[model samples]
Target: MTTAVLEFPGGRLTLNRPGTDDPSLRAWSSADELLLQEAFEHLAIAPDSRVLVVDDQYGALTLGLSPFSPDVVADSAQLGSALALNAALNPACAAPERVFSWLQPPVGTYDLILLKIPRETDYLDWLLRWSNGALKQAGVILAAGMIKHLPDRSVDVFARTVNVEKVSRAVKKARLITCSQGEASLDNWPGIWKGYDLEAPGARVNAMPAVFAREKLDIGTRLMLPHLKPAIESCRPCARVLDLACGNGVLGLSVLAIRADIEMTFSDVSSQAVLSARSNVETAYPDAKASFLHADGISGEQALFDRILLNPPFHEGGVVGDHIALRLFEQAAQNLSDTGRLIMVGNRHLGYHKSLRRYFSQVRQLDANPKFVVFEAWRG
Candidate 1:
């Protein structure tokens, strides 16, 4: 893979994606360019003014507007690392004081707010609600995205919380959404939803807006649960378990609920997902020994586990691919004990068995449904 560079008016930024090793996917999209340009044009900030930037994919918008010292919020730790590294490479721009997650956005009203449209409607709604109170009465909010992702509902989220001004015409298939302050406050931002899965009727799963399968048990995870129970039951006492790319942490949490003798580790690339998992696990099993990791699929982890559970993500930044899943498989193989097993669920069409064969010595199908399949593999 080749290094991807973003050449803007003042400086150039070299960036690499956070999770996968693929360098081709590191290139900045048209939406990032449009947003940076529009922010430079319509959004103004004095050096002392407070500005907020939400969901900056890389350092493009954050570094582009470095003069203002805007507060940048991103969910990916790897993206945050990239921003810091890029800022060091390009001295003209300074990295934000601290990279913030949605769980901990900057406080106080701002003079300008910029958002790159997110894929999840709930996340977009939650951001708009936060912006409603964070923006000064005279402040302006600019949102930009690829036309393919910028839906009417995305704009309506702003309309519901703030006053939509006018959307800019498409520029290279990218558009900008501009809005003004409204009377709405952040009092009613959607909080966590509590529910019990069919398998774990006694354990409550708490989900936030940004987490996958926020409302209920997803079919893939549901299918994997039954297969996990028997394997977990047969494991030696005090076995260590890892829930790689754990979304809501339901897989690990449910398993812990059933057997209290296991030590569980919940990991994911998304900070919001990690936060949700930590909260749910703590709330449901306060005394359970669980570690929550916000990482790129156990890239930096040194500990090995007796069992690894996965519902690997195949998509990145709205584009679907198998590179991420394959990377996770490699890490799982390295992080498993000699006698450990890797249990995973994936869409039948993904054909992950071929990839599993590359890492594990033995791969066996444990269960399958019309849409999903569960497999267990030994590390050997």
Candidate 2:
């Protein structure tokens, strides 16, 4: 694996994606270097302090802070693995006190927070809310991202939680924003949205800016949702369900609304999607049994499910790739109970049917539109 080495202050770090094919894909980005410099110059890292590092990508911020504090929070399992692998390569850097593999905030309050803006807006919103409640009054929140991807809305969201100040821009296409605690307000912001009355209620769905097509339903999902009726009808009442790549929990929400007695579980790689799904599930089915987890598909669990609903992601970060979606399918197959089914929606051009056939007893097209198709794969 190719990795980029970053040197600053008292530490030297190497970053890389575990098992990535590209040897040239180094671990650190220019933005990462910029954030490192900013942290060294302005942020005070106390030996006894607990610092939360959000969305550190390949552990740039987490590894960088290892010397000062080992406490860290990472939202992605893949990133967490990469961080562990990199740390193993260099035994000198102190390992984090605790590393969270999911999107949920770390358990305790912190004195300092280092945030690298995520690709999703909804995740960013959830982070702001989590930080507002978890950060101490004297703590400082420092965030950085490329100027182009850093939305103005992020600044607005930060303003609502704390007093924010933008620091000088770095040559590496990045800028840093510092947030200080202030008179806290009730974080009433809805992390999930559930359409009720007109739409079936009891589907807790939250939105984060990072959720793909968050403001509105994705066209692919819209097309696949109708096909779910057949699968839902065929499903046993109150069957255990899994919403693989559950996005904002739209598919799962729809399923819950129709089958009120069914139990649903939502999973997604994006922290924003998980938060949104959790909120939506809570709002729509307050008393219903359902849980949302931040996970990389079926990697977090081995239990088989009766049904799995998926709108798998076709890309990984900025790179257009199908490895993630393919993995989701492979795992879904391994995790399905006997007589269970994996119902998914995908673009028409992608040859997922072949993949599904390899894993399931039968793979059939449930429905189709101009650009997308809903597929069903049953485990014998």
Candidate 3:
């Protein structure tokens, strides 16, 4: 694997981009570089300071401030792995004191919080609400992101937890927002949404912050459901089923709701998605034979599944490509029984049928709308 080198006043660092094998794709962004520069310029910390780093993309911010042994929080398992890899390469920087998944609530009061704003405004909102109770009275929160992605809503969410202290001038098309802890309490948290309606009667979904399609049904899934219901029912005596790249475990949970006989496995490369899916499964079907995996393409477990459901992601770290989905096809093929079938939904523009044809003996389109198509391929 190749690496990108970023040098700052603190030190020079080498790291890999999240979810990609290409070395040319620089891991650290200008926003990440600016955050480090601003932190070094404005923030002071003790060796044992209780600091928190949220959404440190590929470990730039986490490793930069690692000398303080700050606790790190991230949603993607891939990000966590990259951080570990980069930390190993940079021996001088101390590893995080502790790593927290977004599924878990913020643990202790932090004197300084470094946030890299996420794409979803709702996710930023939830993070800020949680930070309200996680920061000390005199704590400061510093957030940075590309100017194009950061809008008034991002600042509004930051203000929810802290008083806006300053907004940095745009540097390299990125900017920083400095905030001071406010008097907000935890009770006012705009918490997660639970019991959202599902197509299956009496089925509900509990979505945490940052999970894709958390607020409402995604159009692709909406299009796929019409075909999934029948495919799931026809693949009878399905002792085991795997929901690949399961987000919030909605696809698996939906199947479990319809066919209670099947043992379901929800797997994703996201810590937050795994945790959310586990919680959603346990809450709805306490006796359900469901397992949640934080895995990259079914690396370790043994049993082959009778069916695999996938709504494979087309992008890795905001870079659009079918590489991930194609990999999923190969993995799904390897994990299926001789009689097993893979049911997947994708945008029509993705041309997934060509990949499906390469992996399975028989492939056919199950359903399609203007923008999305559901395909089923059977292993022989």
Candidate 4:
């Protein structure tokens, strides 16, 4: 992929978004530029300043402020890959001192904290709580996001944990939020909720703030659960199963509820999602053969599976499209055994039936409701 240059007043660096082939998808957004302009031209960031950049999207916020050698904290494994790619392309840019989890708050106080405001409400609240705890009493925070994507209650959330100083006027449909250290204290920001209980499709589930369907099972996953038993019948004893893009481990947990013979693997891009899934599975089926991975889809997975369950995400952060699902289909095809099959649930409008044919010889409709469709794709 070709690289694009992000040129600010004081520095310039090359960046690339590695997950897609679309030419129009640039690594950085208007909010990234606006944040850098506000930080360099207006605010003060000394050479020796302690900084932490969170949820950098691609590499804009971190790379744009590379001079100060800011520490990196984000939930997405893809973000870590993006930072590595962009840093290598721009060799002069200093690497982050520590690439860590947002759940694991920084060791010491920071002079400045930069983040791209998240869309999830509970997650945002958690971010603010930990951020406030790590921020110096007089430290500053610059949170940026696209105006269309920014939730109306986001500033209200920031207000709960931090002192909302000001909001920038929309520039190129993007806005930046400024904040000072708040009085709110952190409460189980990174750990699983002791009493988080919810009814999933066929089992109980517990999820963190950022996980998809944390409070309850979504209609799509619920619609897909009844079809899982039929798919498992063909599997031999102790067959391996994979739950791609598994959120909160509900799908795999549901499968485990039926039978404990199969070894289940759950993988997702979000750190919190994986941790939540791990806790849910370990708590319910203490001896069930299960593994959780924080990954970009099935990127490094080489093990062949008898059955692959997927409810692929159509959106990445603020952007929505079918590209994410399409990519997962390709990976699933490569990893499925010759006679193995893939069972998937998705919105009916996504029309995955036709897309599945690209990787599999036969695409059979197992079940369907008004809004969702379950498909089984396998080699003839």
Candidate 5:
């Protein structure tokens, strides 16, 4: 992570982001700038305005609007970390309080809600529904994103509820959509539960709109599923196993079906992901001894594990790289027993075999296909 300054209309902010020192990768985006700039110019922003910010990738929107002292809601804990660090660098600005997306929002209605439009339309629809009830009767929302990064149907989704009131002119490859409460309700939104079945163990996987691999099994996980049973069975009785970055708890549920005696913990940075995984396990295996953590990697877990089954994500927010996975590997090494092993799945080109050796004494291939490969690493 490195420091980058965002020069907005009123003032500038110094922020830090985890991974990659690329000069091209700044902490804030064109959308962040345009959203704040437009709001300051067009909207009535008083010192006592009840402001709310959602999906702020880092601290840009919250810190930029520090005069009003806005509140934040985010799905990613990584974003919370970035905002905290960035606030420290710019000591004069006050950092906004953040709540997880799956948790209860801060009390009271908000006069304004600033959002960074996400990449998923389904999630966007859910957010719009949630925002409608959270906003003051006469309040407005400003949603912004890079044109290329915005979902194809994002504007259409916004048109339904918290209806799109106006569209800002394109500035620096970014656009902002102004919205106000409309005659819409979450009557049939994807706010309910749903699941898909895995043929072999019949584990019903559940995922929400914003979760990773929402409705179907991704290729990498499909390649890694067959290898999980053997790895779970190989360890001694009552072995502790972790589904690191577990999205829908499919991997952990599959382990329970094969060996129900082991202890299980599933952790992911996405708060919605943690909720979806917990729902899947509770629906499928009511008595299954499983605990869930909504934190980055394994930072919140205290117990070491005998086997760690990981299908680490290659991308964080929208930036694609191996830095996130590499950090997970180092954390896995710290949380694994001396003879414990880590079984991970990655694209064949990532060359994780070399990276795993940096943390473990030995690394070997477990399975592979045309596009995906699985590796097993352990130190003796």
Candidate 6:
């Protein structure tokens, strides 16, 4: 892959992909670099001050701000991996020890925050909550994105919560919004909510704006969810289970309710989804043992599990593609215990059956609706 040197305010960045054939589909948009440069030029970042970065794709902002005490936060496992790889490529900058998982911000207050407005509104709402909680009394918040991507309501959202100032356009493509502490109170912000009911009694899945199918259950997941009956005649004793690509965690939480013995792990590529799923789990099963992580499927940890459930995302950023789903299946196969089962719900057009058959000895159709299909494959 070709390396591009990006000249910025503090220093120059050497960016490149790992492999020649599999090039980066996207580069740090001009807006991303402009936002970082403008923030550094305008804001006085204290050397000892804590800095938080939200939705930093592939560590661009995080790496650019390496001189400061920057904590990188992201919901996508793929982005996280890319950050690590990029950090390794540029060894001069210190590698961040703690990357906060999706929707889970670090506990302490921060002096400054750099945010890239995400596509999901629910995710943005959740971040707003974090902003309310973590920003110091006089802390500064700066967010930027391409003008086209910035929603009309985004300005209203910032204005209602904090005092905001829009910076003059730098590259003609992006604009920066700087915010400061205001009289607005956190009590007013309604967290992202999407109305959906899980099969489990009393389990509701309301997603933040950024998650896929935030308004309701995705047709694919909805199709597969009904077929998730206990594999054993009676529910098996609690075991380790995972909900990969766990948008709102409807699937895992439902499983947790039925089999009280299972320890559930919910992971997704969206921080908002992680936050919503975490809240749903707490609301539905207060005493249940579970962990919520913002990850790209199963790439981060190697925890073996008895059962893995997934409603894997087939598209990347709404573009119809199969790379993400294929990666999820491959990772599931690699992570499952010898006797573990990977059960997934996917769109029928995606042809997940062929993918599952490649990894598992047996793959069977659990159920199907007109638009989606559920498949169960056991790891050999």
Task: Give the top-scoring candidate (lDDT).
Answer: 5
Q: Which ten residues in a row have the lowest lDDT in candidate 3?
A: 186-195
Scored by CA lDDT, what does every candidate get? 0.79, 0.72, 0.78, 0.81, 0.83, 0.73
What clash count goes with each model?
0, 21, 0, 0, 0, 7
Better of 3 and 5 by lDDT: 5
TM-score of each model, paired residue for residue: 0.90, 0.81, 0.89, 0.92, 0.95, 0.82
lDDT of 1 at 283: 79
For TM-score, candidate 1 versus 5, the one ahead is 5
TM-score for candidate 6, residues paired by index: 0.82
Segments of candidate 5 deviating more than 4 angstroms? 42-45, 191-194
Q: Is candidate 4 or candidate 5 better by lDDT?
A: 5
Best candidate, TM-score: 5
Summarize candidate 1's per-residue lDDT along 1-380 as a digit string, tens digits: 33577876545776655555566576467888877776666544344567788888767788888877888877776667778767776787889778887557677888889888877777777667777788988888887888887644776677777798888888888888788987766575445344445446366677777788887888899888878788889888989999988878989987897789898999887888888889888878889989888886776546789999999887777768777788888888888888899999998888988889999989999999988889999866
lDDT of 5: 0.83
TM-score of 2: 0.81
Tens-digit lDDT track of model 4 for 1-380: 44678888658878887766777778888888888887775445365668888888888888778777788888887877778888888888766756677445458888888878788867788778878888888888888888878765886788778898999888989999989988876664543342234453334677877788787678888888888887887788988899889988888988887778999999888888888889888888889999888888786445798999999998886667778898899989988887789999988898898888998999999889999898999988
RMSD of 5: 1.7
Name the better of 2 and 6 by TM-score: 6
Task: Give lDDT tens digits, candidate 3, residues 43-75.
Answer: 554445577888876788888887667788887
Candidate 2, residues 1-380, lDDT tens digits: the string is 56667787757876666535677666766667776776666555455666677777777777787766646666565675667788886787766756774454567788777787765555666666677677887877877777777765876667666678666656667777778875544366565333322144433244655666666667888777777777777778678889888777888888877787888888887776788678777766778778777766687455678889988877654556556777787888888878898888888888888777777878888888888888888866
Our tally of clashes for model 1 stands at: 0
Worst 10 residues of 5 by lDDT: 39-48
CA lDDT, candidate 5, residue 21: 86
User: What's the C-alpha lDDT at position 379 in model 3?
Assistant: 69
Error of 2 at 177 (Å): 3.3
